[model samples]
Target: MSSSYQALKPARPDLDSAGLPYSPDYGDIYHAAQGSLAQARHVFLAGNSLPGRWAGRERFVVCETGFGLGGNFLALWQAWRADPSRCRRLHVVSLEAHPFTREGLLAMWRASLAPELQDLAAQLHAQWPDPLPGLHRLEFEGGALTLTLGFGQALELAPRLEARVDAYFFDGFSPARNPEMWSPHLFRRLARMAAPDATLATWCSAGHVRRAMEDAGFLVERKPGLHGKRHMVAGVRRTLRTPGKARLPQAHGGPRTALVIGGGPAGAGMAHALALRGWQVTVVDPMAVRDGGVHQGHTAAACVPLIARDDNPRARLARAGNLRTWARWSALAGDAAPLRCGALQMQRLEGRAGDPRDALAALDFPADWVRWMEQDEASECAGLHLSQGGVYFASGMLVRPPQLLGALLAFPGIRHVQASVAALRHGTDGWQAQDAAGQVLAVGAVLIMTSAVASWPLLQQTGLPADAAPRLATVQATGGAIASWPSGRLAGGPSCVLGAEGYVLPALAGRCVLGSTYEEDKTTWTQTARRLAIAEKMPAMLADAGLATTDGAEDWWGGDWAGWRALVPGRLPVLGPVPQLPDAWVATAFGSRGFSWAALAGDVVAASLEGEPLPLERDLLEAIRP
Candidate 1:
């Protein structure tokens, strides 16, 4: 693999006379002439002895060198679904140097003659990501099935991946066409990633490839080929007669029950993730169960992605989190779904030195994801007068927090307990939560701290040493308030959420939400002053849109004010396992970006706990690790 990140150069397949996908670059066909599905089962599934090998297993992982059209993955998923004794969780990690575009994939599926294959292909295409570098995780079958698509060279990506793969599919182009993929170094990396007794199979039965596998400690065998081919190859990791360097640690089995200590976005998100994996989760919060948990009273909030000039960790995490959140919410019903109106983030001309739009333009992101809009275009998109142009996220959402939280906690396996956790202790059985009087509130195999600033005090009560975690001291609680005005007061507000120094949401439930004021020294902001401050940020836009008059803050004052606590230190959230506590994890410090960070952060935690392929790259995970 290349040493540095290489953006995917998607493949364009041409149809042969027989309507089969023929790759011009490789000068070869994608699958056997018999059929793609038939070849997949024969060369990969049966070669690895799957469905039988994975039967009754708690989790099974398969790593593949090529993901052309995703035929093998879909075939395996369909088979797993049909099997009564299939593994509870199926993870497929496939590295593709040249992935096909969504359209290309759809075209291939259309040419296919199989109905079941077409149906599965449609599902894969719908979730296909923009051919971005690094890893992109797509979940299916309610999270029971996961596909980790590595859009990079296999040599670099294989070492980066952390999985105890039970099976391997070496299905890249033929050795004659792609010698780099059949290198000995690649086989050695696969051996390092394989679990003990791991099996491997491939349609390529070249002598050199067999020798490479044998040199890498795999017991190799040549088998009869499918579709009248000459021969195929299958292998298993052979136990070494001599001891090598210490092998990588195997993934531990995650607990069946989890105790989530919050009902806010983070807690609810974690609960939903664990519940999807068949874990029984209990969420405890001081507040009563309501439509939106902690954000119940807020009329509206912006669920928009953030962009930085360099696409830093926070920016990347925000993008991943926003996408995951959208997918999760889109699957829900009733009030759980967010209003799909887009959001406009206006350019700041006050103190900032450079324009963000210029940096964004250089990135060449997809227009459907985000686009630079001039002042006139911005106004046209918002249906309100605007003084400046900024970035517009086409898929931005105006979400009601409570509604989303309620839906996340509504999973059948999730149970909510209305109580404040006064203490946390690790006993022989597992972790336990207690109230102030020392009465046990809940007990579970794992504990997730998502109570924001309150989590520090609770962590201190765990009786661990002071050095166990020093980073918790850096967390600071800041006060914030969102003021709302009667929708009728403003003749017409922006069509969607308008964000600049402060944010203004379009009318929801007869009111427009104008947020917010951040005060570190004071717990509450003067409603009049806070409203005036927000109104001052976009005075011209508000006046032009009939939201305010020349009298300055007078028209926007005297509205309702809602306050909440935001915890922040480095802006990035603190996630992953807590220090000195094996089963305890922290998912806090979300600050004002809770809506943007919740879903992805929850996924990170879930992946860590369940030993599944991570949704993020290693660098990003380390950046946010607690």
Candidate 2:
């Protein structure tokens, strides 16, 4: 209702008389007069008994209101890193409506970071997301530490968060300066996200703030403030949850066995996400050894996000999907990660007719994500561009699906069982994955079908149609193919992705990929005209980008790879638990956006299994849920 798209604003910091960053909008210093590092340790960590509570625990979740300079998070990381009994995994979810620029944060941390945290500071600088409204997850310490930054107003974003927080850090500005942070409504929603014994700490000990916490079910007390300040506040959720309503145990709790059907991008992402969350996952795919690896099935694909005039569900999904894909695959999720070389989206009608720059201006998206590019500027970014003006994505990537799957399936807790899963049944023990002969191959407490088009047959057996998961019967498949050429042949091809009716990627492994001809059938592409579809629809689009393949390109057209896309009428990816089944999930119908949808879809399922906060908003979750 409020701008539809949450356009996050970067902080225009103002320094106080003491040389510390202050907010002219709120008329308050960023942190205590003493310093952020000291304020973080004495006020938040010690106040919450963090090191003691999280000690020896497998995983701990912390939610904070303000992530100003991220000094508190850094301090917490330092404490966790130094402690031998630290939790095996740490997750910090924080919100900031006005986040500082990544460059600004790096500069601030460079001057203030201690020796022990210098490396962490550099990582923060490297992985900090653009000031875009949504969740951006940054990982460190081999992914043992996760920081989820929500760049939006507290009232707007808190209700969308789905987490069971163990502790909270309520620090951004004073309650008097920002009343919304200490509002009764925000406190109540946060309380709903809190665990039974969840605790919180804040530098502000104002009376109204205390009353708000009490009204929101927190038992509050006034504590000694830091430095010369008079008082600080600390509290805990006072009520014990009823037996049936309590959150299910996490990594250390219960058997974490899972059967993931599919070895493609979706399934690989699912396997990686679950394995990271401590699940003993077995991936079932018969073609793994025969047709697996980077050279087979689909060699390379574009993983860029999309946008629309109205920022529709598809656009939002792409943004979230790209964020997840770039963040996860960019690091330890897999070895053959996607190359973040960026993409150039061509406006088919050119700059003068049906221009998108006007619509983009209204959206107010940060320049770090996407911005209108003139032909001259686009040429420089692309390295060999000579064509129409359009939007350039600084965060797009080119992904090798098979290589990614190979690496993801090799994660510690995931095992690859090459099996033809023909049937499924839920019985007394758990959900079972069986062969065509009815022999059970894998039995797991949780089952997620991510087999793309192949999943439809198996889904029909789950008995979910008569009860739940609507519009599933209408799922269809589309066949698509892409042509590849030796980069040596197209010597002047753009160094960035070029897209119109279809797209071409920069060279990888001495080869450039182009053309994604789509066909109505889901199983196979029409071989006769498969290579010419792109040229037929948008003639000479490649030639305009200085990538003319008119002569030698015809010879390399034979090097084409084909795949199938599972899609429904609306083209949204289906995810979440099946309505009538227990712990059974589906993440399919990605259609043509497999590379874009796979990463975030995995998160939706894993978050359900872990009972942790979701990476997406509630409305977005429902729009695609099975």
lDDT of 1 by residue, 185-298 (tens): 888876776778799999998899999988888899999999678899999888742123323334446468898998888888889888876788889998864567667676
Which 10-residue window in model 1 sums to the lowest lDDT?
240-249
- Top-TM-score candidate index: 2
Estimate the lDDT of model 2. 0.78
RMSD (CA, Å), each prediction: 3.3, 3.2
TM values, all candidates: 0.90, 0.91
lDDT accuracy of residue 127 in candidate 1: 96
Cand. 1 TM to true fold? 0.90
Give per-residue lDDT, candidate 2, residue 588.
87
How does each model score on lDDT? 0.78, 0.78
